[model samples]
Target chain A: MNAITARLSSFRRHLDPAVITAFACILLLLFLGSLYSRNFLSPEYLLQQLKVASFLGIIATGMMLVILLGQIDLSLPWVVTVGAMMSSAAAGFGHTGAMLAIPFGIFCGVLIGLVNGFGVAYLRIPSMIITLATNAVAQGLMVVYTGGFSPQDSASPTMRYLATGFIIPSIPNSVLCWIIVGAAAVFLMNRTGFGRSIYGIGNRERAAYLSGINTRRIVLTVFGISGGLAAFGGVLLAGYASKAAQSMGDAYLLPAIAAVVLGGTSILGGRGSYLGTVAGVLLITLLQSILSVMQMPEFGRQIIYGLVIIMMLLLYGRESLSR
Target chain B: MKQWRFWFVEHRGTLMALVIFVVMFLIYASNHPAGFGANMVQTASNKGVLLAFVAMAQSLVVITSGIDLSVGMVFTLTNCLASWLVVGSPAQVILGIIAVLAVGAVCGAINGCVVIYGRLQPIVATIATGAIYYGIALALRPFPGGTVNETIADALTGKLFNFIPASLVAMIAIVFVVWVPFSRSVAGRAAYAVGSSETAAYMSGVPIKRAKFFAYTLSGLLAGTGGLFLTFFTYTGEAAYASGNAYTLFSIASVVLGGVSLMGGKGSAIGAIFGALAFRTIGDLLFVFDFDPLWQPLFQGVVLLLAVSLSAFGLLRVRNRLDWFT
Candidate 1:
């Protein structure tokens, strides 16, 4: 009993402003959704929300890792779009092509991530500026290549199964995939040497380097991982939607960053948890769901989203000061 | 010769950007001599003047180790406000201009307060405020339609002196005004000091909060001025007008390309002005080449990357040479 209490105390102590606010947001959203629409409480609606949240959650997981490394990857939306496009195009080539497409998509993501890592880590440029530039490059290339159209195709049985098919007749395969990725990410972040090294480098690069850690390698690998995960999410999204559009990635940019920041991960790097990020993903999706159900205009929804993010940051900043 | 070399070294980044601009123009002129003449010059100059002001606004905050992601949004807000408020009379139009500047300043002050007093990160705070400002702009002009007086627009857009473009003259005048305070005042020096080392500056008795507040307020004022110029150029107001993605990229790119460090400290108003011109010239050159609009963002990305990389290389060289001399 005493041990359990102590464990709980430790967990409570670790609770950051992002986590608290995300929780409050989640509860508030659930409450508001229920009040506004009875359908929101139904299992079907909740499951749908979870399914959508899973897509963002998976990408946010990678975003959290990159942020944890004291860097950012703004090219995520385009990377995701590329992944979706590749997968859709591959599906058009038949089953063999579909099988090949998953790896190919992941490869594209890894390549871009590597370029970003190289520019930021080796070149020692600011990540924000570098990633912003790269994102533009990727998005521009996508626009030129796609000409502002969605690829018309459907995934193969395997891809479709991962996207729309169910694991337990009610739970979505996408949700399952999210759970597996989330669990693996949590374990990798908490119990792995690589994770410790990431935190170390994020906290103090010189100290980490002196301690014999290959800081550059760690940074590169984290970005690579982030890219791969984002690609996987895109593949899943394509399977679910049955088509991929040019600007599909634009919507993910803010949410991916929002999840990481709302999960209590410091944007400056090195201090956050994957579990918290997962919660944040759920919270944001819920908030959006509630707002949509309330029949708010698109602009109004965006305004509220921005305001909530600001409020969360303000609350977090105040808490940090008091501490 | 020594003085010339010293000037070149001090202004190398601006010089490089200018060279690039000239080379691009020459290439364009060679290909399409007819279109690249006075008409193109007028359009490009007008565009450059507007962006120069926006870039200057961004640089003011950036020099203090902060960024104003809301500048584009603030421009949109003021543009819409100008259209709505300037309809009554010429006096009202003047009042509208003052009101726009005041609103911009207040918006910037809010950012300053949140960042300094609330101790929030500048990027995150501005991003949030950007959303709010954009929302307000959208609410003001929901479907993108407003008008300015035709006479006022023509006068503002037309040449002032016989040979000189009014827009160019206005840009030059604004540059001079900004330069006086930034290059010749203690407050301006304090901005550099705070950006270079905030903690050290604070310890040395610089009122860090005041400096930060003033930087943001100046940034807002510049953004408002940019909006006013946009009205003169376009003669119409739309909520979504001038809120292009290119605005954000070009604003940052112009400053960085002109030798202003992203890490803060060590920049000039002249450099930012040149950077804006270079950016506008690049766009004109691309359009002359008949490059697809879809590729614009990609080109911008490459240009920004190259510019920043070149600037970083320059800084590195300076450091190495200093080390060698020491």
Candidate 2:
């Protein structure tokens, strides 16, 4: 009993205020919506919301890894877009081409992620600046290639299976995919040597290096994983939307970051949990849904979202200060 | 000859920018004969002036080892205000300008207070503020359509003398009046001290919070000026105009390319100005080549990456050379 209590206290220390507030906000919004709106309790609406959240959840999973290393991938949106474009463009070539495109998409993501990781980890350049540049490059490339139009064909059967198809009648295949991915992520983050090494590096790179960890390699690997995951999310997105547009990934960027931050992950790096990030994703999706249901204007929604993030951050910042 | 060599050694980045500019100009001239004259020059110069101001604003915050992601959003807000208020009489136009600057200053002051008093990191705090500012702009003008006085626009777009553009003149005047003092004054030196080592600066009696507040306020003022210029150039102010979504990256790129250290405490105002000019010139060259507009963002990103890499390389070389001399 004492051991369990100690463990709980340790967990509490790691809990970010933003994550807690976000969770509460999600619950409050859902309760309010269910009370006010007639269709809020429907299985179809709930399932649809889950389906949307899955895409963000998958991306945020990889984003969690990157953030754990104290680095960010600003190029995520474009990479996701490029992946969708590649997937759709390859669809016309049949099954083999589609299969080939999956790796190709992942490869593209890895390339950009490697560039970002190398610049930040090795060259000691700021990650934000490098990722920002790469984002521009990636978006530009997508526009040049696609001309801002949706691509020609639907996603392949396998991709669609990952997106829209389901294990059960009511549950979305995407949500199932999210569950599998989330379980694997939780295990990897909690039980693996790599996970511990990531935390060590994130907390203090010099100290980690001194302790004989290959910090640089770990950083590169984490970014590569982030890239691959983002690309995978792109595949799911193509399946859901049934078309790959040029700016399809733009909307996901903020939510992915927000999910990671709101999941109790420190923006300054180190100390976070995948489970918390999962909760964070659900919370954000619910908040968006509630706002949309409330028929709020775009500007008002933005204002509320900004205020929530700021207030949460302020609370977290003050807590850390007090500590 | 020794003195000249020393000057070259000290200002290698500036010299490199000049060489690149010449090479790009030649490429554009050779490719598009019609674009080689005053028209191209004026447009490039005007873009450079606008970007230079933004770069300067970014540089001020960067010197304190912080960043202002809200610069572009603030620019949009001021632009909108200017458009809405300047449409009346000239007195209204002047008052409008004051109001816009005041609004900008207040926004920046809020950022400063949050960072200093509220103890928020500059990056996170500015990002949130950026969203708020963008939201306010959207609220003010949900869609695209606002008007500025044609006379004011003409004055901005027109030339001062026969050869020089009034916008360029305004830029130069701003540099002389604002940039010089901010970069050379006691407060400016204090800013450097704070950025270099905040604890040390505090121990030495420097008002770190005050210096930071000044930096943010000045950044806001410059952003306001940049927004006014943007309105003049574009002749309209929509909510989406000058959105922070893209300029956040561009301003940082310009500063980095200008040889400003991301870690802070080592760069010049002149370097930042030239950096903006070089960046604008590159874009103009691309336009002259008729590269697809869709690829522009990608090109900007690639160039930004290359610029950052090159800056790092330059720093390495400088460090090596210093070690050898020592």
Candidate 3:
């Protein structure tokens, strides 16, 4: 009996409470939603929801990494915009631009991430301030690029295909993109030395350095990856929307952070899982859908999101305190 | 000489910020088409006070080593609430003012409860509360149409003695009424202690939680004051998401520029007020230079980044790298 109890406790340790809570919320939302609309339970409806979740999921993945490093990237909004704008603008060029469009967009994201990394890692600036400044700079650049008018370019065929296409019957191409990105994140975090170092740095930068982790380099690399991922999320969004618009990335910043925090990742860093973030993304997407179905106003949705975050923080804070 | 150097070093950040603000304002005034006239000064003061009030609110929490991202939202919510309440009659207006302040205090108290008792990180906790406050503001002023008592609005926002700006005077009154007493109080010292080092503060038998709570509550009140001023200036209430976000970001910039360390336990609201004024001047500078309005955000951002980066220079002088983390 003692052995059995120990095993169960071990299993519990493996299962994060935040993830469990998020899953339960998702299920509850789905059940409650279905009661209101019969179509809520339909495969098509859920699949569409999954596709939407994928965009947030991808952004949240990068957010989770930054959070794990005891840092944050507030530049997600502009970085995503850069990705979409660069790709779409490239598409307006000849075939070469079309071919290079996606890469160029991603490259913009990577470059921003590198800049973020440089500031945080070398200049030793706080990621929060650095990212915020970078975000402003990006906004300024984009504003100049668009020349205060609407972007004239539209999504390329490949971009549109990636956003709207389906791979395994019913599963969206965007979800496929998310899966690939998510898998890579999980592998990097779980299977590689780099992943462990992130946790170490998050847990304690000085200690991580003492342990020979090259803390600065890891911080730089992680920020870069985060930038790249945020940009990638933007690319998918543009594809889905069929074009890039001004300030298109604005909506994602809070939600991405919300998803990361909801997924059970510690805002203080050094502890969390991608699995929890996935659950968080799905839960938020479902909650949003349910709110829409209920014909709730945008303000109501914002209130609900805010209340839910505070409630979750309270819950998480309590358990840690008790221990 | 050593004592003088010590004093200079202690006040260096604040002094530097003050010097920067003075220089920027001088340059801005020199470039202005109308020069430093009463009209221009009044307008600038009116614009600066909005951010100044918010930055002052931010400084309270910042002093306690916590941040209040919700201050801007509180300002917005109170502005919306004021537009509705500050209209009816003289007595009604007085009541409206009290109610707006009360609402601000209550919002700050809520943030206090979450961060102190709930033990949540200030950033996330305030972000959540900020959103909630913004939601409330949106609900109150969905279409952005309301009226403030024009008499009161004019009295507060307009020039005093037909020479000095009434807004600047009111700002000074608030400084004396709110900031002076708070900084001199035990609770204020406790906040400073907590900001410098929480464990050390606790060990010193400071009422750490109480200090933090008061900091947050006062922050809300100041933000609410800002909101009331907004109503006075605009004579209407509009729950603008972008504006609220901008204020939040700019408040941080102002705080940093004012010589208040983001690390906490340093700087003064006076410095922050100057910082806000300087920041407002940057936009004016652009206008006077005939730059495209679109370039405002970009220029402001670049200037902010450069200003903030200056603070990082101290990191290089630290002998122990571990000091960087702290």
Which numbered prediction scores highest in TM-score against the true structure?
3
Kindly report the docking quality category of candidate 3: medium
**Predicted structure with the largest DockQ when compared to the true one:** 3
Scoring only the A-chain of each prediction against the true A-chain gives TM-scores of: 0.93, 0.90, 0.95
Q: Give stretches of model 3 more than 4 Å off.
A: A1-12, B1-7
lDDT of 3 by residue, A1-323 (tens): 99999999998889988788889888888899989989999998999899999999998899899999989998899999999999999999999999988999989998999888888887887777888888988898888889867698998999999989976888899999999999999999999999999999899988998888888888988988889888888888899998998888988988888888888888879999999899889988888888888999978988998998888768764434431
Per-residue accuracy of model 3 over B1-326 as CA lDDT, tens digit each: 99999988877767887888789889888888988899998998999999999999998888887888888899999999998999888999999999999999999999999988888889888999988999999999999889999998999988888899999999999999999999889999899999999889888899998899899999999999999999999999999988888888888888888888777899888878888888888756899888998897788878877876776788879998777776
Candidate 1, chain A: TM-score against the reference: 0.93
Which residue pairs does candidate 3 place in steric collision? Answer: none
Give the Cα error of residue A48 in candidate 3, in Å: 0.9
* Per-candidate interface DockQ score: 0.46, 0.48, 0.59
Off by over 4 Å in 1: A1-6, A152-160, A318-323, B1-11, B241-244, B290-295, B311-326
Q: Which ranges of candidate 2 are over 4 A from the true structure? A: A1-18, A38-44, A318-323, B1-32, B241-243, B290-298, B312-326
Give the whole-model CA lDDT for all candidates, comma-separated.
0.77, 0.78, 0.88
Reference-based TM-score of each model:
0.92, 0.91, 0.97
What's the C-alpha lDDT at position B267 in model 2?
68
**What TM-score does chain B get in every candidate?**
0.88, 0.89, 0.97
**Deviation from native of the Cα of residue A241 in model 1, angstroms:** 2.7
Query: What C-alpha lDDT, on a 0 to 100 scale, does residue A154 get in candidate 1?
Result: 60
Give candidate 1's whole-model lDDT: 0.77
Among all windows of 10 consecutive residues in model 3 chain A, the one with the lowest summed lDDT is: A314-323
